[model samples]
Target: MADIAVSTRGLVKIYSNTVKALDGVSINVNHGEIFAVLGPNGAGKTTLMRILTTQLRPTSGEAYVLGYNVVSDGDKVRRFIGYVPQEFSVWTDLSGYENLLIYAKIYGVPRHEINERINEVLRFMDLSDASKRLVRTYSGGMIRRLEIATALLIEPEILFLDEPTIGLDPAARKMVWDKLTALNKELGLTIFFNSHYMDEVEMYADRLVILNKGKVVVEGAADELKRSVGGEVVELTVDDMSKTVHRVNEMNSLGIRDVNIDNDRGIVRVIVDNAEEALPVIITTLRDAGVRIIKASISRPTLDDVFLKYVGGKISEEGRLQEVRTLRSVIKKG
Candidate 1:
C-alpha cells in the first residue's frame, strides 16, 4: 500500500464557461487516515468528490486516487475505492440484503465471500435486524448507514462518504461517526469524507481540507487551526452616549483579531490574540476613555471561529456564531 492514497496537483475543472467547479486545487490524503473535505453548499465540494470517484473528468491538471490516475486509469481507481454518494443510490424497493447482494455481484465479489461480507457489514452497522427490511421503510439515518454498509461490503481499500449524516439526528449521527472511527482506527482503513458539521469533523478527521468557491482554503490539524484563532472574545457592553465608533476602532488597532458591534444592542465584540493580556487593557482603556463598561470576559476560540476565518472569510460576512442556524454559518456558542 502506498503512503499517499490520493494526490492532486493544480487540479482544475470548468463547466459551461461560467462556473469554475474546481480550480488549481491540490491536496494529499495519507494512507490509512481519515481526511475530511468540509465546505458549504455550492463551494465545489461535490465537484471534487465526483472527480475523485472517477465519475467526472477534470478540465486540466492531474489527480491520482489509490495510485491510479483518476482520468486515465479510472476503472482501476474505481475498483479500489468505494463511494457513498450524498444521494440515496440504493434501490429503495429492495431490502437491505438484496441491495448489498446486487452491489457485491456487480463488483465481482467472489460468490463465497458475498454471504460473509454481507452478513459482516450488516452486523457491523448494527442493522442485522433490519437486513430484511425494505430500504424505503428505513429511516433517513438508517438508510444512510445501510449505504455505508453497502460500501464496506467490498472491503474497499479507500472509502469516500459525502455528507453521510446530513439529515440524521444527533444519536444516529454519533453512531455513524463511531462506526467510521472504528473502521479508520481499528481496521486501518483510509476514509475520505465531506461534511459541514464542525463538531462531527472535529471528532473523526485526522486531517482536514477546507474548500471555498472551488478552491482549497486551508489544510491542517484541527488543533493548529483553532490555535490560529489565538485567544478569546471579550464581549463588552457599552452605554456611552457618543463614543462607540472611536472605542471600537481603538480596540481594533491593538492587533486584536476583530471587533464587532451589535449597534442595536450596544455590545462591542472584541477578538484578541491573548485574552488575559488584552481584556484588562480593554476594560481600563475604555474606562480611561470615559466610557462605561457593563461587562467583559475572555473565552475559547471554537470551531466556528475557524470556519468563519476560512469559509465565511471569503464571503465578507460577520462571523456571528450563535446556535442552530444555517449550515454555512454554523451554530457556535460562547
Candidate 2:
C-alpha cells in the first residue's frame, strides 16, 4: 500500500560523545498495518524508537511520522502518535480514574466531554470496575492495559509500544497481546513495536523487521520466511564422529549441498535438498559404518535460522563469548 505512514531516510543518531546509536537506518511502515522491529539488547531499537517519538533528535538525516518532520513539527506529531515506553509510566500512587482525569486536564479535553471520554476509555480498558482502586493495587497486566488506554485518549493515528509485554507472566503477556490485536483489527490503529520475543512477533505482527547491531537484517511475514528454506536441516548426534563423517560422505551422491561437523558435541549437521527423500540412504549409510547414534532430528527452517542466515555464521555470538569469559573467571576465582 502506498499509504506510507512512517518513513525514515538515512536516519542516524550519535551520542553526546559521538557514540553512534542508529547508523543510517531507513524503514517505511504503511498505514493501518502492524509492523514489528526485532533485535537484541542495545541493538538500537529503543534509540530508533526514541527518535520517532521525538524524545531524541537524530544526528543526521530525516524522519517523518504522519507526513510531518519529527524535529520541526514534534508537537503536531505527538498529537497524532501515542508511545508507551518499556517502563511503567502511570502514577502508581493515584487511582485509575484519578490519573485519567488529570491527563484529561493536561491534554485540555473539552470540559463537558471529559467525563464522557474518561468513562468510555475506562470501560474500554476493562478498568471501570477498578476505576477508584489505587494503581499500587492493580496487577502488572492491568496497569499496562490502563497505560494503553491513556495512550488512546487523544485518538492517536499511530501507537508505538517498546517491549510492551515485558516483565509480565506468560498469561499476562498473552492478554496484553490479545488486546493489542483487537485494537489493530477493529480500530485499524497502525501499531509499531520492538520486542525480543519471537513468538510474540509471530502472533501479533502482520510484518516484521529484524535488526542486528543497528541495521535491518531481513523483513517479511513470519510464515513466508519460515517456509522459504531451500533445503532441510538434519542434526545427528553420534558417538564416533570420525566413523559417521566417513559414512555421511557417501551420501554426497544423494544431492547434498554441505555436511558440517559439530566436533564439540560429536555431532554432524547435514543439509540436503530434500531431507525426507534422503533419509533412508542417510540412515543406511550410518548403520553400515557401525557408528552409534545418540540422537537425530529433522526440522524446517525457523526464525532463528533466518536470523543466523542473514546475520552471519555467528549470530549474537558476542554475548555468548562474554558469558564464557565470565564463567571462566568465576571458576578461576572459586
TM-score of 1: 0.84
Model 2 misses residue 177 by how many Å? 1.2
Off by over 4 Å in 1: 235-269, 287-297, 313-334
Q: For model 2, how does the per-residue alpha-carbon lDDT over 87-172 read when each residue is reduced to its tens digit? A: 98799999998888888788778899988988988887788999999999999999999998888888788999999998899999
Query: What's the lDDT for all of these models?
Result: 0.81, 0.81
Q: Report the C-alpha displacement of residue 98, candidate 1, in angstroms.
A: 0.8
For model 1, what is the error of residue 112's alpha carbon versus the real structure, in angstroms, after optimal superposition? Answer: 1.9
TM-score of each: 0.84, 0.84
Off by over 4 Å in 2: 238-274, 284-292, 312-315, 319-334
